[model samples]
Target chain A: MIVERKSVDLGELQLDSGETIPSATIAYESYGELNEARSNAILIQHAFSGDAHAAGVSKKDGATGWWENMIGPGKAFDTDKYFVFCSNVLGGCSGTTGPGSTNPATGKPYGLGFPFVTVADMIRLQKGLVEHLGIEKLLSVSGGSMGGMQALQWAASYPEMCASVIPIASTHRHSAQQIAFNEVGRQAIMADPDFEDGNYYDGPGPGRGLSVARMIGHITYMSDDSMREKFGRRRRQMSDESSLFEVESYLRHRGGQFVGRFDANSYIAITKAMDTFDLSLGHASLGDVFEPFDGRFLVISFTSDWLYPSYQSQEIVRALRGRVKDVAYVELPSSYGHDAFLVEAGEQTEIVRGFLASTFKKLTPVGAAR
Target chain B: MASAVDTAVRADFVPEVLGRGDYQIIGEIVADGSSVLDLGCGEGELLAWLEAQRNCKARGVEISPTKVQKAVSRGLSVYQSDIDEGLADYPDQTFDYVVLSQTLQETLKPRDVLHEMVRVGKNAIIAFPNFGHWSARFSLLTTGRAPKTKHLPYEWFDTPNVHFVTIPDFEELVRRDGLTVQKSFFLRGDRRITYRPSLLADSAVFLISK
Candidate 1:
């Protein structure tokens, strides 16, 4: 199905940093129909560098959704059975009010002058959109990576609004290594001469810098085993400055493509939001953060995902189990590294399909006739 | 975490799905509406059965990723974990029943597992093949080999059942550990063998407490 992107005028939104955006708009896409009780709504959150197009062919460019594999008619999310909604986050370039958005105050793109945002602010904007759609409580709030962090935030910050939370290949907070990698990406963008302090709207922007940053990101997203298998020892040529590795060639192509689609300023805004995100911040412990929450949780991690390892997922499960809350956990066997949640959806399709069906069944009360 | 709550999407839960006699006996031992943890729960057939038929809260730990998938698909709460290394995450007296069905012999440290089970649950229902059965004994005495009968089907060299225990051996350990055997059921296929059960029964199930 060809899907059209819709935008909601959410006006001003308060940031976690005590600042406020003059006007906030969220670009979104929805699949399936909302039932009478509005209980079948499942919110799909996007990861860093991802847009609101989570499923269906986009009308703007005819590009397939980012998570099209698992969010279609009979797929894991099963749009036919549940109303699946995805929104571009607060500090995103994809039609959402971010660094790319025109600032009402100056009649120019926010660029470097955009008010700083956080994961909490992202969810807060999404919350406005979800509530605008007339959904009181989501049947589930689900996502992977940064999306997963949003999912956990939904369950934690708005416990009564989410019936269940699915955080896949994600963590409650960024590890030192995770922050370090994101920092490198930010530095690559800032070092570009064309970047001009995020005010490159009148120029070519930071295309080269953003490309190199994405190249670094692509490396962190794959596993050693996958890299070896994908581009063995195949070499076309050799040079001191240019080591003609096929992997390097491939990364360069991917990085260049990323620059064509993503904005460098938004990249900085989103990454900083991700780097500072900590679900347990200020709480005595991780367990303490979830003490008042009663929503069910489903936590998934991949075996080869060193960037966001299975142990991180285990920590969430451990905290939930300690509270005697309803939770399930599995470290699936995969060689796809951090991209397993997106790349490998076969077993996840089965596991998610089952988990959602059971939860929906419980919510639908059988009458005395049964 | 890919392992926990996405509650509403599991397959249709069919009550009375489990037909195993030992599971039925164990189900009887479990109180209605109580919480249960099944170790080595396979695809969580018994846990699903308990949840649907008995209105009990069912949870499980299975080592295989494949089985964990099946159980989650079946609407059962299961963790993918080795049973020996699983219970440490849970607090004391977390469950009404801790089940180890046909899996005790495969454990590297059976005694330690038993101890952990009783510590984690108010009661534990253990079921294992009786190594002292008449057919098993006859096979060992007559052929002078590691007994390979219907119950203990594997050959000695490749057997996964590393710790072979008779009814007497288990009872002695229970006594040594100061555990109380609340109930016991000896089975020869579908029939209960109360007369000389140690020599006649193929498998045995015991409901014990600390």
Candidate 2:
């Protein structure tokens, strides 16, 4: 359960937009050991607002990793069998190069000056990290939401690098509805008086705007059923004169906690990247986007996840049908909405465990250790 | 419950280790190393069996989410969807065989689904309970009520087979649709019946192609 945060200097990175970052640093954490063949590596991509801390308890605080339940000695990722790698994304604030990171040229925080990073770019950078670990091929690449997007990009971009992929609660492209949601969040952050056009690194720094944005995001992460079950029309008494609705108080609390851990500039950079994510950007068809993939796939979606509905996952499955010989898809019934991938780990464990085991059996040499 | 007659013809098929069951017959009919798509593949037992025995690339579609979960847990590729709606997402003749086992009688539009199966696959394997069996005829004649037997176990109100078809009715429909029957099998409780199957057999399986 002991976890340590490590940083790697990726040197200068050329952005997809033709912009160049003078220096890039990727913060990552690893669990378990890589096999002699370096084939038992599983890359875990974190979702929007998530960091490198994926499993085990944090050393700084007594807190568990974001995907603590899904990755451990006996968990779905199975640390004992496969080496699990989780890294903070390129356009992330948590210990990675982002808007918060000081620009080498300016000798100050990058703020809005950070180059726009794409989902494909993130995978390219992650490829650097994987190569640094001496792994030529990986067992699987997996994640949910933005993390899932990165996994999809990995499959599309470097098909031979991984043996399998598990993209849960994710889509091949950002739908108009998804783009609109991210746009609203971005607007909320930009409109705040304290935002100061993303140059408030020296000041209090757009706390109210960022909090509002987080509140909007938190609502979309949950379903109507889950929200109703957690907090009905019940109200909380703040004082004898006034009271607040339970749901309102809950959103405010989540927003407050998010502000402390996240930076507003990084939120804009990351959400914008998610909005522009499309696997079929230059391809003729969605199937063409996945035609080069030579690995097994396990695509999962939640029934109540309106933000990224099951149909989106089905679309990916449809595209992959004849193209990939080994692809499995499941739409699990859950009231947890878009956040089900994180909250409903128990329901996902069996499917994930079976998929990894089967894919591993197929990929491993016959005489290799089990 | 396999009879002596069933054991005699079992040698005709390439030997495969399969448990004695109705689906095992369907599994045996499937060609080795051919891709398969099973409609209404409950819990993916047949698909998994095909993968292990025939070494075929198998996929399935089941309407129930619970069954899809079970199928996924067994490492089978299955999508949760209504088969009656058709396999529009799949390209033409993508699979070598499309198997609709036992669940065809419960479909709202069996003929349309069968047509879709033919369109998406080079061949279609269909299985359904024979409503014109002697036991069902005897029950209807004597009791003047809808037959309720081991194959048709549900009560009138709870029966999923809304449009049950007798063996003759299905044969006529197949002929009318211009589909050719490559092979046919009739069973009386796991015992292969070749003589007067419409009247004696309790279940019918057909391998058809357009």
Candidate 3:
């Protein structure tokens, strides 16, 4: 049986420049047994728009998570052997405090009034949760895309805190192409006549705008080849007159489904944070940003993902290689585009399983500790 | 495996460098704690030697599957990749030293390979069989065939050496590219020669920085 628990609180977390934010509620879930050693705990970060329901049946939906394929008994991130922890990001909307959460000070939904949150702020909240759970060190950290960004930040900010880090399909910074896609999505949301300067809470506040934003986002998440293969000029089976183009039907399905769960203001807030994320900022250059990292890293990339191309992952490998030989890289052959990580179960599970075992060995009494 | 006394009948077998050349090439080029990318790293004998002797961490990029498997089996990380395709996959200056040992002559484009090697690595060490050796000259003039000796041992039809180069030829190529030759070594078997060895030497090794 899986033992699950959640801790939601408005804790005080001090920022980097000594600014303290009060009443920060973070929703998280933990599974399995926390051993007496507390060293077998593993931290799994969710990607952009993902919530704390990383594994198992969520109470909200009574359904499994996006990564349901490899997070069960005897699975890659097996709960039988290790305790796993996953939390909603600081700037997320799902069950956690975000733009949709009510502000204690003003007694109104934060909405557009929420202060800007960063990847560093997300890591800080994760640190508090880890500390709250009484875990001294993590066996491994695993994540993909925006989740990978958080994992990399954790490894760099607290190098000695984790035994190993596995970052998948992510770059040190958002590239020009990524920035352009995000900008288009944001524009789609803001251009709607119903947006009304982001005060969309009371009346029918830009549901169409939010759905359009999700449509653009879904398009970017898939590859051109996948789109051509899935929707190549074919019309919808039932609604021929309503949906003439096959691509339009696909986009409408995605956009319609997303409007049911996601909040538009949270979408704007999180994407803006991701756009401004630069792991190499504040440091002299790329080399200097990674100079202080002294840990084992496993960087994985997908071959078909043009959004965050394999070359970007190779840059991370190169930067780590500049300082240490413990870094390893693998670009998996996949045709699922940027979503390959969530779809290519066989290759993704193998790579992650190998990485987990190695990290476990490093922390266990069987081998040399890192 | 041929002993120095017995191998004379066959022409294609070139003896591997059993010991270090006199100048200690790996140590001279590698920094105190550097990562090396050894291209065409045959048998990984030199890389193992460098690691155990000098405490350097070495990874290899070899074309031959047999050599790459051998290197990995020896606990040295090596991958099979073609350098001629460009190092766009590898970020700039990922390695401190990139060594191409006696394999540059066989490449389709030597100068383009050099730029790629330098692009991926901070410094490059290239060693090749000197075509200006007296025996090679004598063989070309007297027998009208490509040279087949201890170092350059291949028939003209089957030789992998597409571009046979001498010390002066390589020097001219380097000078034209605005690259500097940091150090140079001329080898006759296992000893180093200080005198001009363009005519007498059987092979030459060079350390260049771009």
Number of colliding residue pairs in model 2: 0
Predicted structure with the largest lDDT when compared to the true one: 1
lDDT of 3 by residue, A248-350 (tens): 9778888888878888888888888789889989876666666666656777787789988988887777666555445655667777788887887776665
Q: Is the docking of candidate 1 incorrect, acceptable, medium or high quality?
A: medium
**What is the lDDT, from 0 to 100, of the residue A15 in candidate 3?**
58
Best by DockQ: 1
Error of 2 at A188 (Å): 1.5
Ranking by DockQ: 1, 2, 3
Per prediction, fnat is 0.63, 0.53, 0.00
lDDT of each: 0.88, 0.87, 0.75
Candidate 1's DockQ: 0.58
Looking at model 3, residue A50 earns an lDDT score of 80
> Which of 2 and 3 is ahead in DockQ?
2
TM-score of 2: 0.94
Clash number by candidate, in order: 29, 0, 0
Candidate 1 chain A, run of 10 with poorest lDDT: A361-370
Worst 10 residues of 2 chain A by lDDT: A321-330
- TM-score per candidate, in order? 0.93, 0.94, 0.71
lDDT of 3 by residue, B8-105 (tens): 31111123333556325554556656778777776677676566545676766666645644554454544444656524456678778888888889
